[model samples]
Target: MNARVEALIEQARGMTSEERVAALDALQELVAPPDQAWGEAWARESEERLDAYLRGDIEGEDFDVVMERMRQEFLVK
Candidate 1:
């Protein structure tokens, strides 16, 4: 392993069990792949958007209206 990783591992080894668990959790998040992190962020954003839509904080066409518009655009092409 790289020197930094080796050093980090040694530091983790010196921690207490509870600290190790927290450290492991933090490390896992730190090393998580970008796409996995992005997926989580996107999920959170989607939930927030849905909540806002439900609360009428966001205004937009409904799904059927969107679909109909898409169909008309496709037919024109």
Candidate 2:
């Protein structure tokens, strides 16, 4: 790594957990900002799903039931 990044990492090591998280978030935004188009697409998708649910064209499962089923399918003993 470059000296500047190494120096930043060393500085980050001295921060509290929360401070480090905030710094990391700031750096991530600088590296790659949030995608507004993706957010708008998801918003539209969510509205469509809700409309379908209201129209009785789709059904929703209980959160706990879905979690239990997912655990059974994916978790290894």
RMSD of each: 13.8, 3.9
Error of 1 at 12 (Å): 49
Clashes of each: 0, 0
lDDT of 1 by residue, 3-77 (tens): 998998999889999999988787777897358788999999999999999999998788999999889889766
Error of 2 at 73 (Å): 1.5
Q: Can you write out model 2's per-residue Cα lDDT over 3-77, one digit (the tens) per residue?
A: 999999999999999999999999999999989999999999999999999999999999999999999999996
Judged by whole-model lDDT over C-alpha atoms, candidate 1 comes out at 0.89
Candidate 1 shows a clash count of 0
Q: For candidate 2, which ten residues in a row score worst on lDDT?
A: 25-34
- What TM-score does each of the candidates earn? 0.43, 0.60
Worst 10 residues of 1 by lDDT: 27-36
Runs in model 1 deviating more than 4 A are 1-34, 74-76
